[model samples]
Target: MRITKTLWNKASAARLLLYKRDASPPSNAVRVLGAMLGLQFDFEEPDLLQMEHRTPEYRKINPMATIPVLKDGDFTLAESHAINLYLLSKYGGEQKEVLYPSDLKTRAVIDQCLFFDAGMLFRRLLEVSQPAFIGKIDSASSTHIRNIEEGYGIVETYLESSPYVAGDRLTLADISLGCTVAGLEGINIQ
Candidate 1:
């Protein structure tokens, strides 16, 4: 019974770690990471080293000096999607079977959504939200709104077949859309 209890506890812990509320990345990346790990999160202000990206000190930790940098012990990694996948793999395990998908065929579909999320969805969202978030509503553009709508329309079409991009599963694709669409609503971009 003790061994059984210990195993159960470890499994639960791993499951929890799979999706913790992280604040380092923009809400977009956090949402993707949460979706990939099958976790929900609330956005918060992150506690980071106070320095500019181009600073000499920061470059030692991240030569690229990007905003969303992940330092896991000695292994520091970059790239938003790559970091999301790494976090899922490190913490989610078999529970992430649906999100990450072990099957090559299923994985391909998830990959397509991930790519779209990183490319078009993010692009549209960033362009639309930048002006508003920075307190410059006048900077918002109809072109940005159109771009965002196009991506959202694609997601709507994809949703018609499956509940999510990976078909009947609330995969990382859902998380990406959820985050992106939510941000759009926040900025009142329609």
Candidate 2:
């Protein structure tokens, strides 16, 4: 099923299709960022547990079979980080531009932080989660807990100098990292 929204400016507005998971932190980040930018998008939720994302129809949209896929008109893209960057670049106005600065240095820092979240923080969480999802483990092991703690320590150090992850101002890095960190709630890592 698909739900479309007609924005205020139809001529300039592009139809956005977002494949998301309701409980997914990455998906939540995309939804929050879109709302902040005042961009309307259609949403489709595919059940990963039920293997819905593995179906032919879903695979056609994203060969990687990942949630948080974004389709703008005919252009399809997977990965939440890439989607957030594209959305901001395409729809962000002057006021919204601060979220992802045009300055080369600032943009680089934001990109670095975003990569850290993807490669380090979120990766650690997934290591713990994927095993539990398939009944490989009843709970996180000592090593998994240590890894999560180490990731948190890195985040804490990064936050020491600024309120947000990248810097003082809110950026795509913050949205991405914030959502990834929020996923730690349900896990018994404590």
Candidate 3:
């Protein structure tokens, strides 16, 4: 059933630390980072098949109606990318310098990879999955398949530049794309 309550607000009640309904790729990326940071989350499983994210309560946590809303203390943030970066910056402790170092040039490279993942790679994956998920098609079309190849071409270029997308050492960029690439593979991108 669709959530009809329109008066619910995030400000009224907020004690949740983390809300992840499943092991979706986006949430998994953050989960990987959280594991590296040795952090434990307060998980609550909800049926995505039932569209729980469309509920008023879930919307209060993430207006985008997405999974894996991070609520650490008074800070309530949505979006896995933002949540991952914030967690690394705030709670990374010693691992902060290694995973997401504050260096200028390295950080720029990491940022580039993140942007590429968010814009091109992830978008291409969505083109295929969204339609299939809604029963618009049985599988990805040739156009969507070509788009996925184009995304992989970009990945190839990044790998050619260095062993990792960001450089020698693994960074948050790799984690983001790792999850996205896994999604792409789910749609047979590879």
Among these predictions, the greatest TM-score belongs to: 2
Q: Model-by-model lDDT, in order? A: 0.61, 0.83, 0.78
Q: TM-score per candidate, in order? A: 0.70, 0.90, 0.85
List where candidate 2 sits over 4 angstroms from the true fold: 1-11
- Every model: Cα RMSD to truth: 5.3, 3.6, 8.5
List where candidate 3 sits over 4 angstroms from the true fold.
1-16, 21-23
Evaluate residue 168 in candidate 2 and report its C-alpha lDDT on the 0 to 100 scale: 88
| Error at 88, model 3, angstroms | 0.7
Best by lDDT: 2
lDDT of 3 at 171: 93
List clashing residue pairs in candidate 1. Answer: none
Q: For candidate 3, lDDT tens digit of each residue in 108-168?
A: 9888988888778888887777677767888777889888898999988989979998899
- State residue 8's C-alpha deviation in candidate 1, in Å: 14
lDDT rank order: 2, 3, 1
The pairs that clash in candidate 2 are: none
Off by over 4 Å in 1: 1-54, 63-65, 135-139
For candidate 3, give the lDDT of residue 138. Answer: 85
**Which of 2 and 3 is the better model by TM-score?**
2
lDDT of 1 by residue, 53-128 (tens): 5578757756866545555545666556776676677656665785778889888888898788877887787675
